[model samples]
Target: KLSPPLPLPPLPPKPIPKPRPLPPPSFLSAVHQGNNDWWRYLMAVGLIGSVFFVLTAALSTLALGLGWISLAPDGSVTIRDPLVSYLLSHLPFGFLGLGLWWAVVGLHHRPCRTLIRACGSLRWGRMAQGAAIWLALIISPLAVALLLNPGSLMPQVDWNQWLRLLGLAMVLTPMQIAVEELFFRGYLLQASGLLTQKPWILCLVNGILFMIVHLDNPETGYGLGWLALYYAGFGIFTTWITLRDQGLELALGMHAANNGFVILLVSYGDAVVETPALFSATSFDAAGVVLAFAVRALGFCALFFGIPGLRRDSVPPLQPQGSASEKPPGS
Candidate 1:
C-alpha cells in the first residue's frame, strides 16, 4: 500500500493482431493431411507399379511397331535400339507419375500450387544455378579423364542416328530425369518426411527406396558395387538438398544436367540406357566414378549452398502440421 497502489500506469493499448498470410501449398505439407501408413505406401506402389508395367508394355509394343525395337521369334527382346529402349525405360513415368500423384494425393480435393515446393512455385534461378554447378562438376571430371586416356573414349557418330538420338534425347531425357525427381526425391521424400521430422531419416528412407527401385538397371543387375554406391550417393545428396532448399528446383536441375551430360558426352560401358553419345567410353573409369561423388557432394554443398544469396533465406515459414488452420473443417 505504497501510496494507494501508486495509481496504476495507464493501461497499454492492445496489440492489433497482424493479419496472417495464407500458407503456401506443398506436397510435403499435403501428405500430412490424410492418414499415411504402410498400407498407403503399398497401395501407391501397386498403383504406380501397374501404371509403369502397362505404360511401358504399350509403349514398348509401339516402339517395336515403329522398328525401334526387335522381338525375336524365340521371345527375346532387344534393347540394342537405343532410342526405343531409353523411351521404354522412362516415358511412361512422366505422364503416369503425375497421374499417380494426382490420384493418390487427391490434389483436386485440396489445391496446392505445386507439390514440388513450399513457395507455391519454383524459383527458376535456383534451378539454373543447380544445373550449371552440376553440369560443370560432371563434365570436368570426364573431360580430365578423356584428356588423360584419349584412347579410352571413341567417337561413334552415325550422323543420321546421332541426330535422331539427339532429337529424342532432347525430348525424353529431361522427362526421364523429371520422372525420377518427382517420384523419388519429391514424392517419396515428402511422403516419408510426414513419418518423421528428422531430415537425415527422411534422406535415408528416400535414398534406400531410390537404390532399391533402380535395382533393375544394368549397373545394379550386373552387381557393380561401385555404381551402387554412386546411385546411393545420388539419392542421398539430392534428398538432402531438397530438404535444405525446401524445394525440388535445385535437385531437378542437378539430376537433369547429370543425366543430360551422361547421355550426350559419353556413356559408361555397362549402361542400360544407351544413347548415341558424341564419344563413348570403352570402359567404366572407376576413378572418374569415384571423383563424381566427391565433386557432387563438395561442390554442391560448399559452392551452391554456401554462396551469399544462394543461402536458403528465401523459403517461407511452414505452419505446424496438426494446427487448427492446417486441416479443413469437419471430421
Candidate 2:
C-alpha cells in the first residue's frame, strides 16, 4: 500500500518576479551626477540673474515708451492698470526660465530634465494630484467664509475683465511658478547640496534668501514682520516638500494652484500680482494671515504624507552624507 502511494510528481518550479527598478535618488544627487565645479554654478547663476535684470529693465522702458506705465516726479512709479502690470511683470519669468534651461544643459552639461526630476521626466499624475489637493485646501476656507459672511467677498471684476485675466493667467501663471521653482528649489537647492546635505540647513538658507527677494512684494505693506515670516515660512515649506518628494513636481503643482487661485478667484488689496479676481478683500487681518498660513501648512503636510498611497513609492528622506550635517564645501 505504501509503495502504491508513490509520491506525486514534483510541483513545477514557481516563477520569481523581477524587481522593479528604483527611481534615481532625490534631486540632491543632481549636482553630483554632473560637473560640480564651483565656477560653473556661479556662471549659471550670473547668466540667469542677468537675463532677469535685463529683461525687467527693457520691459519697464518699453512699458514707459508705450505709455503703459509712468514714472512720477517723486521717483514713484504709477501703474496704468493692475492687471496689465501684473501680466507684464510675469513676462521676464519666461525668459529667465529659458536661460536656466540653457545653463543646465550647456554649462552643467546635464540634461535639463535633471532640473525637473531625477528620472528626467515630469510625473504629470503627481502634479495633477498635488494641484487638486492644494486647490481644495485653499478653497474650502474661502467657501466657509462665503457661507458665514457673503459680504466679506465683494465683486471686483466685470465678466470681460475676469475673462481677460483668466486667459493671461492660464498661460503665464504656470510659467512664473515653474521658473521660480526651478531657480530656487531646483538650481539653488542642488547647488547648496554641494556644500551640505542637511535638509534643515538647506531649508533655512533657502527660506531666508527667498524672503529677502520677496521683500519687494506689495504684501509687505501689510506688516513687514508678519509678511516676512509668511514668505520665509512658505519658502521653508516648499523646500521641505521638495526634499521629501525628491523632485519639484509636487511643489510646482502646489505653487501654481496657490498663485492661480489668488490671481483668478479672490484677491486682496495689496496682492503683489494684481488680478481682476471675481472677488476682493479690502483688508486682511495680519494675525489671521499668519495663523491661516500655519494651519494650511500643517494640513498640507498631513494630507500629503499621511496617506500611504500618496507618498512617492518607497522614497526615503534625504539624509546628510558621511553621518554629519555639514561637510567641507565641494566635498
Candidate 3:
C-alpha cells in the first residue's frame, strides 16, 4: 500500500540526453567560419607559398647551373649518382618550401597542422588507413593490370641496381610525394579555398596546377593533354577526399603509397620519375590505363570519404580560433 501510494507521486523526469560533442573545425570549415577578407587568406597561404616555391625553384636552378646537381637542358634532374638523384627528387618538398608554409601559417597564429590537416596535427592513424586503402584499391589493381599485360613491363633488372633503386624509392620517393602533397593539397588548397568555398572550383584550380607542375615530366604516348588530364584528375580525386575528410592524412598516405609503389614496382617512358621499379610500362593503352586508374581512384574516394567517426573531421573546441578579425595583426 505504501509503495502504491508513493508511486502516485510521479517519478522525477528523466534528464535529456546531451548530444555528443563535435570536434574542432577543420581548415575548410575554419576558412568558412572566419570572417576573413578573401585576400587575407590569399596572402597568408598563397602568397607565402608562391614566394617559397619560386625561391626554391631558383635555388634548384642554381644547383643545376653550379653542377651541384646535374639536370637535362629541359630542366629535369638527371639521376647519375644515386645520392644526388635522391636529393634532387626530394629537394622541392624539403624544409625549404614546406617549412616556409609552416612558418607562414604560424605567422598568422595558426598552427601549421591547420594548413596540413583539420586535426591541427599529423594523424598517423588516418594516414595509415589511407595508405592501406590505396594499396588495396589502386596499387593492387595496377599490379593485376601489369600481370595481365606482361609485355608492358620494361626489361629485367640487375638485382644489385634494382636493390639500390628499391632503397632509393623507399627513402626518397616518400619525400618527393610528400612535397607534392604539401604544395598542392596543403598550402595551395588552403590559400585557394579562401577565395571560394566551392569544392569544384578548388578542385579545378588545384588540379590544373598539379598537372602544370608535371609538364616537364617525360611520361609520353598518353599524349600531353591526356597525361595532363590524368594528372588533373588525380589532383581532383585527392582534393575531393582531402576536403571531404577535412584532413590531408589520407591524401598524404594515399599519394605516398601510390607513388611509392609505382616508383618501386614500375615506371616507363618520359615519365617524370625514373625509378628502378621492378617493371616499366613499355606499352600502355592510354585510354584503358586512365580508365582503370579512374575506377580505382573512385573506389578509394568512396571508402575514405564514406566512413563515419573514423576520426573527427576537425579538432575539438570548435570556437572560431580562425576568425579573420582574430587573425594576428599584420599577419
**What digit string (tens of lDDT, one per residue) describes model 2 on residues 225-326?**
877887787789889988888888888888888788778877777667766788777557655676776777688877878777665556676567541000
- Tens-digit lDDT track of model 3 for 53-154: 786788777777877777568976555654455456566666445555544454445555565765566779888988897777755655565677656556
Global fold similarity of model 2 (TM-score): 0.89
Ranking by lDDT: 2, 1, 3
Clashes of each: 0, 0, 7
Clashing residue pairs, candidate 2? none
TM for every model, in the order presented, reads 0.79, 0.89, 0.74
Cα lDDT computed for each candidate against the true fold: 0.67, 0.78, 0.63
lDDT by residue (178-265, candidate 1, tens digit) is 7778777766776676667666777777777777766666644434565566667678888888767678888888887877776776
- RMSD (CA, Å), each prediction: 9.2, 6.5, 8.5
Model 3: pairs clashing at backbone N, Cα or C within 3 Å? 24-315, 24-316, 154-280, 218-270, 218-271, 219-270, 219-271
